[model samples]
Target: MCDVGETTWLDATAQAELVRRGEVSPAELAEQAIARIETVNPKLDAVIRTRFDEARLEAAGDLPDGPFRGVPILLKDLGCTVAGETTAFGIGPLRDVAFPFTSYLAEHFRAAGFVPLGRTNVPELGTTVTTEPKSFPPARNPWNPDHSTGGSSGGSAAAVAAGLVPVAHANDGGGSIRIPASECGLVGLKPTRGRVSQGPLIGEAWAGSTIDGAVTRTVRDAAGILDVIGKPMPGDPYYAPPLPRPLVQEVGADPGRLRIGWLDRPGLEGYLDDPECRAAVAGAARLLESLGHHVEESAPAAMYDQEIIGHFNTIIAADTEATMRAFELLIGRPIGEDEIEPRNVAYRRAGKDLGAVAYLQSRSWLEAWARRMADWWTGHDLLLTPTVGAPPPELGWFTAAGPEEEGVRIISFIPYTAQFNMTGQPAISLPLHWTPGGLPVGVQLVAAYGREDLLVRVASQLEQAAPWSDRHPPIHA
Candidate 1:
């Protein structure tokens, strides 16, 4: 039996090899994982739904034969469908909620040989950065319990950082994947839109702004997972050309003297860069320069477009309303007054208020901006920006007294993440910087659509230089 507790901290790839060699059994790994979750999760509130009995049964039964074999992984509650498991997506929507049948992704998850331990927390509809949703208490950063773990993938990030699990399922529509990765110091890669499917369930999520991926402690784990499940199913809305069989094979491949447009300053929030964020970005920029990559100060031409920002926000708010309406229909109720958050009400109301013209105008603006970004990336292979425009806001910043507080300034600080959502490109948050206050700061690297190979390859190079897997929270098992 495998005891992750006693054996070397083998990443997913190495662990699979050990499993094949009979050095680590799924039962042993599951027992150690359950123990870790018991000891560590109380501090972070990461794993919201634990299927301990189910996990044990899985370990006792026939395991899927894939690269990850017995690795324990958790799915973010918001973006995925697990049969028999209801998706509350934050706002306490579990009243008689349950998955009616299995999803294609669930089958793929099993095919990857990943043992599903349970689900993790996300903001209501994954609309916010702080994981403090009404459904479950906000997930606290394992590094500092008082500080927030970033969301809507916050739980997955916390779990990986605290060693509760090596890697967990995470998704990003806006900055959900990168935000939590920055806060928790993990490798968060938001694959190009449609790189992974939203199918055999729902076709598109958030107007295709968001897509699914994982947050892992090591780059190689991310690479292996992508290899197993990254391909889009046939007859999809869109598809990126297939790469080599193992994405990890490209890791450490020459990034070469590529031109990397780097920004030490935050833009989307309009002068919202904290001293810590700037310093972190600056330091990371220096590291990239020394690492043989050409770094140039460049800002997205789209950064100055207020119309685009408004367009993105309006669409987001409107989508919030649409999703709420869908939930109401799902539950066979009107969603009753006071069932959703106050800020959300404002946004949803704003969405509902928009007439047909405003929605169409928003669509036009998105097409224009995507063209602009494509032209910009055409000249440069990649653009580097601060992962989060502002550092993680203090916990409870989003919901005061559980959403009674309205128009939170935290939303204003989050513009840097949404544009990528609109552009539908591949972006990632690498934990390359940590503040003097000991908070991790992330720098985002983006590639043109279908060029995740570039981002992940570059990330592997950066990982070797500034390894984050060794970094850990003060609280640990």
Candidate 2:
């Protein structure tokens, strides 16, 4: 077999090319991936379960001639369920809840010939942006073990960053995909709301704030994977506007000159991204300018209002409560307080206290704000910001003594990402800068709703201008 260490660093597309050329068999690829996971997953804690034998079995059997035939990937231990596989959602109460059928995304992955060897770790119910689940040890940043791999896609990000796999499933609901991508120095794309189906189970998540995606080391890998899975499944509540052409075609395509806005602050009072993080965005602005894009200083004024922030959080909390209740009904018993994390218990209480009318009002407010936010894009094609408020934090940095504290800490570290999630727009995080301390700092690029084609074009341009794929973490395979 080819050197597992060297092959592991290749993107999924490159690996698939090798399989197509007969340079390696799918079984060999799976074995290499499994070996790498066994080697590094102990230190990273990125994977929470295993199906190595199943992966080998599939690799040896008849496989579809899909683009990604034989690529081994990990499904984040969130909502991307596989039938009969445990989907804990990173909570104590749901640990034993194996899904009865595969989710739409899982089926798409299988059809694309991806062998899911296991599920990665996640925070409880994906409520937080860090992947510290009470059900298992937190997934560590492969760059630095003591630091966080941003959640709830932390495990997926960690695995990709550490070279355990070239790509893994991740979903964004309030920055779950981008935060970890930024923290782990991988390419993270949060597709426009409804870009990918979340169906056969639920039409929408958090009122359409949640969207499925993947973490990858190369821009083309991100685009290629999106091409495979972004199709609108039957019964989807809605779908994003169709792409004019294949996403892969946009990867190296010229974006032409574009107007871009750079917003260093998240518009919160007394809040600023770390100096390094701010510099990262500034550097990206300079890069875009160098590439002929018109970069200016601007942001949507609607993002600063206190009332809007309150309404946003209200919707999220209400969704959490509703999800818990749904699961309670499924199992025929209410989840006990001791069965959940303390902070989530408090979130449930807050959600329960909000009247249904208030919840609907909150959602209505968000939709109105989304319209206003979209209007801001009239003068700009993209907005640039720091992926997170700060670099990946040291473990325990965001620990809270109470739910109130948890709420405060949540927004403090992750201020820029959720706003786009609320707007159902497309945004991406690219690893363009690294701190002097050697941690990765990502710069975010956001485009109008249903403008992933534009995002992909620009992201591919940036990826070429400042390549980060070869910059492996200290703990990589």
Candidate 3:
């Protein structure tokens, strides 16, 4: 067998190329990824469970001939359930509950020729923005062991950042994908809502604000993976506007001169106005200008209105309650307050008490607010801002206090990502800047609804302009 160590830092696309060239077999790639996880996951606590034996079997057998054939990847613990595998959703009591069927997205991942190595850690119910569930140890940032790897996809981000896997399943509801990507220094693309299916189980998550994608070291992997999994599935409630062509084709395509607006601060009150965060956006703005895109300081007026926080929370509360009830059906028992995190417990209570009229009011308000937010994109091709309001916070910062206080802390850090989720728009987080202390800070570029094609094109251009592929965290494999 070839020495698999050489493939450690290769992106998913390059790894697949090696397999296509007969330089390495599928089993070899799977074994190498398993080894890397064994070596690095202990330090990061990124991976929670393993299906290594199954992966080995799959690798040695006939596999689909797809772009990422034989490349190994991970699934987040929260969603993307695999048949008969543990679907813990990062709660302690549900750790051993096995899903009877696979999710559509999980099937798509396999069809794309990727091997599922294991499952990554996540926040409880994926409710918060940090992955410090009471069920398991926190997924530490590879860049700095004491810092967070933003949540609910934090474990996937950590694994990818540390070279455990080139790409891993990640989903975003309220910045779950982008925030972790920013914290862990990987490329995170949250596709337009309905771009990916969450079917054969549920149609929408977090009132249609959540969507599945992936975190990768390069823009091409992000695009390639999306191409593999972003197809419309049977029973899907809705679908994003069809891409003109495969997303991978958009990579390196000229985006042409486009107008891009940028914001340097968290426009909402009570949210952090972090200097490093602002500087990251400013640096990205300058880089876009240097690449010939017209950049200016502007943002949607609706984004600043604090009313969004309450309306969004209303939806989250109701969803959290509904998710708990669904889990009761799945596990054959109701989850107690002590069995989950306090924040989620609070959400459950609020949701249970929320009247139907109140829930609809919040949803209607946000829907209208989304239209106001989308108006900015009519005159501009992109809206750029810091992916998060600050650098990766030290672990426990968000949960050090009561749940109410934790909610405030989370809002303070993530002011920019959730709104796009509500609007069903596509946004990407690119690791373009690093703090003087060497932590990665990502900047977000958002496009109008169904404009992931535009996002892919410009992201590819930025990838070429400011290459971050060679950078590795100190704790990487």
Candidate 4:
């Protein structure tokens, strides 16, 4: 007989199957996740809320037939709500903005038979790349505690990487999910815009600056969550077209030879990337070649410097301001200027001064980029690049008190990610590298808009050729 407690922390798909077959109870699985949180979160601080009582009651109820029935899940702390639970986004200003009801995403997580374990952390207002926030210390990487797990979905990545759960919910607006997934060795997908709903709370956060997804140890688990949670409400701003009859079939099916456009360095950024980052892309290009895909080195003419940085910052900063302002008003107190981390303060200040004309110009430029990139994609199946130009830095690399240095570091490492956000393309990060010290590195894959099925097919092929889920951390049960 299996020990339910010991097995509860197993891959969520397995746990759900076990629960359905009566080998273990949902309560047992919930207890196992809670135990993991208690044992490891003391050092990691990955989660800010633990929904023990509600999870137990919810688990005890009749469940809908689903692949994830009775499995435990964690939601990131920003923008999602669980009716009576507060979301802090890893900052203190909006710490107690409890909702009287669940958000649509919260309800979707529940309807899929996933028990809510709690809320995880993110960067301050999710503006910065590192997870350290003024509200709490950084969410440390489980593989090596000194390095960061990446953000704005750092806490979810940390919890998943630490084995507190097999997979945890994550959202990306400019590489939040993929960045952390790369740093922590997980599969993260940022579905093309409109693949999932941002409804009932508001239509698409941050002017589609945020995308909700998951970080999972297994490709199948990540795909499974997408099958369940990837729905657009009736009046969504847009919707990814209907998927296949069954997503599981798509994951295991063959992705016939693909035409890949490979860029080892970010063309838009101009400066060459570190050798290791370039090597990772070079190495992945070879892997794609071995997998029988036709790979080549070419791109649309390099973009102007001012266009990439200025427009991305303007649109993203404006979105950040709107989210923070709403949060501040709901909390019934002004956010003390001194309370926030330095970068967020600077962004909010910049956003307030953008004025209508500048903001519109930025939006217009983003549309132009989308048009240019979408046309470029017509001749290729995928684009391959390093997810981030640098490896995961020590925890405080970008969160130090010095703003100018932090700004430069952010610019250097984060350029590749925000481009996908601007393009509204489906992008993913696969754990394809292990550094000298055994830290993970990620390679990025981008597909044209509304082509998540294609992205997953290619990712699944790579994962099958070189599977990674079994690469556990030092703390194995």
Candidate 5:
């Protein structure tokens, strides 16, 4: 019998290789994953729902010989609905309602032979940047249980970081995937908008500001899973330009000497980067230059436009209102303040009151600015920055004690990541540094739209230059 504890740290690809060699059976893998979740979840609260019995049954049965066959995976609770499973989306009303059909994303995961072990936690409606959902226990960071696992993919990142699974589903709209990956010390890639479908539910999320991907311990696992899940199903509003070749192949491929730009400044005028966070990006830039890449201190002036934050916030609020209204129709009742978080109620109200013309103006403003932002990439293939404006915050830092407090905390922390979401570019967060206190600090790399291949090649190169897979948090399975 394979030692379950020994297998915890292998990337999904390596685990799959073991299964291929018959060194371990899929059932054995599933059992080990379940064991890890049972042991670690009590402390981390990363996985909020479980399908252990179903996972065991699926693993014991004939499964697809897919690249990651029978690997146990957790789906973030907000998106990617699995049939017969309750997709709570971190809201109170939907917790008990099982989706009638599995979403296309979940179906793709199943087709790739990833057994669904459970759904992870998220902030209510994924509206905030920390995972202290009123609907479930907060997803604690494995690095330090007292610090937050960034949201709304916080649970997925925590599970992956804690070794509950090698890789887990995560999506990003306003940096959900990258934020948690930064805090939890994992590789998170938010593929170009439309690189993966959001179908059998909606055409796109947050008006194409969001995309789906995963958080993993290795760059290879991140790239490999993208190859598995990054397909456009029929009826997608638009698809990202297809990759020249498989993303997995891009890993370990020669990226050659490339021009890279670096930004250590926060986009928000009054905001500042912590010394440790600033050093992480500077250090990554120096490393890039050492590796023969041209490095420069530059960023788009458009990114600093004071109005950009308001525009993105308005759009997000509008989308939230639309989602909530749709939910009201489904349940045939209005959601009360007691039924939802207070901050969201305010957002919904603001969105409901937004004039349609003003909403269109915000969208138009973003589109025009995106053109200006693209010009910066002309002489550079990549832009590097601290993944977040600061390191992971202690738990309750973004508490919903009051609406003003929550908004300020969010603005103070996530100033660096929302720009790419508005531009529909591919961005990834790599755990490249750790603070003196032992918390992880991530360095981000952003590439032009439809240029995930470049991001993958360069990220894998960096991964080899500074390996992080061996680094584990104190609270591992």
Candidate 6:
């Protein structure tokens, strides 16, 4: 039998291979992961809930014969709901509420043979970039427990980086996946909008800016998992352009000489000009140039439009209000202000006060802004930038002053990632640089809509050129 300690560090793809080779049984894998979570989760508070008994039973029973059979995975508390499990979405009132049916994405994860051990933590309703919710213990960064783990996928990223699990389910609306990946030192891919369905319950989230993806330690794991879940489901409102082949096939494939634009400065005014972040992008540009790609300093003009912040907030306010209503329907009562976070309470009020015309105006304005942003891709195969405007901040950084101050902090931290969510483009965050303080600073590579193939190819090249798989956080198993 393989050492469980060594197995804990293996990526999801490798763990599945071990199961296939008969070197490890599914039950053994489950037990190892459960032990790691039990040992490590107290320090990080990453796993908010556990289903260890159910996981063990599933691992011992007949399992699906899929690409990732026997691999244990964590689901984010916000979405990707499984029947009979609580998806509290980091809200205090809804903490015990369980959904009756599984979401299509969760079904895909199970069909692809990932056993769900538990759900990770998230900010209330995933409203903010950092994952410090009042409802649960904040997810501490594995690299430095004092710093924040970016969210609402922060819990999953922390768990993965800490080696509690190889990979975990993460969805992005505005940098949730990539932000956490950047902070926790993992690979986070935000697939093109509609690439993964939110069906049978949700058609769109945050005005179609949200999409499901995962954070992993390897590019191939990201590609392989995307292949398993990035399929069109019935009743999906829309679908991304189809892939020519499975994404996993693109790993290590040559992404012929391509023109890439890089940005080191903040995309929006009032955002940070952090030295570490700028250095991360500059370093990635130099690396890309060395790898035979044409790299130049450039970015979309639309990124500077200050209107984006307000419009994005408008959509979020509306969605936050709607989400609260949805929860009320589920729990059969009106949620009081005290039960919700202050920021979300303000959002709900703003959404309730917003007239239909004003809401439509914000949506229409963003639609036009997306078109302007997409034009940059006409001349460039990729855009490279810092995943977050700064490295991970200390815990409570976002909430120290209150929601109003938190808004400014959020914009400063995440100016680069939310735009792609609006434009429906596929973007990835790679842990290409580490700060002098030993914090991870991720550089993002964005492809045109539905061009994950290109992103995967170049990411694999970068991964091979600068391998990060061996780099583990201080809080590792």
- Provide the TM-score for each candidate, comma-separated: 0.94, 0.98, 0.99, 0.95, 0.98, 0.99
Pairs of residues clashing in candidate 6: none
Question: Which regions of candidate 2 are displaced past 4 Å?
Answer: 270-272
lDDT (tens digit, per residue) of candidate 6 on 1-477: 777777987999999999999999889999999999999999999999999999999999999999999999999998898888899999998889888889999989999999999999899999898888988889999999999999889999999999999999999999999999999999999999999999879999988999999999999999999999998988899999999999999999999999999888875468888899989988888899999999998889888797888898999999889889989999999999998889999999999998889899999999999999999999999999999888899999998968789888888888789999999999999999999989999999999999999999999999999999899889888
Better of 4 and 5 by lDDT: 5
Question: On a 0 to 1 TM-score scale, where does candidate 5 land against the true structure?
Answer: 0.98
Q: Compared with the true structure, what per-residue lDDT tens digits does model 2 show for residues 1-477?
A: 678866988999999999899988999999999999999999999999899988999999998889999989999888888888888888777777777878889889999989889989999999888888777898999899999999989999999999999999999989999999999999999999898999889899888999999999999999999999998988988889999998999989999999999888667654545899889988999999999999999988886667766887788788889999988986789999888887778778889999989999999988998898889999989999999999998887666446667667887887789989989999999999999989998989999988999999999999999988779889988
Q: Once superposed on the true structure, which residue ranges of model 3 sit more than 4 Å away at CA?
A: none
Off by over 4 Å in 1: 2-4, 7-9, 268-271, 401-408
After TM-score superposition, the amount by which residue 180's alpha carbon in candidate 2 deviates from its true location, in angstroms, is: 0.3
Clash count of each predicted structure: 2, 1, 0, 0, 0, 0
- Candidate 5 lDDT score relative to the true structure: 0.89
Candidate models: Cα lDDT each: 0.78, 0.89, 0.92, 0.80, 0.89, 0.92
The C-alpha local distance difference test score for the whole of candidate 6 amounts to 0.92
Better candidate by lDDT, 3 or 4: 3
Tell me how far the alpha carbon of residue 403 in candidate 2 is from the true structure, in angstroms, after superposition.
3.0
Please list the Cα RMSD from the true structure of every candidate, rounded to 1 decimal place: 2.1, 1.2, 0.9, 1.9, 1.1, 0.8
Q: List the residue pairs that clash in candidate 4.
A: none
Q: Candidate 4, residue 205: CA error in Å? A: 2.7
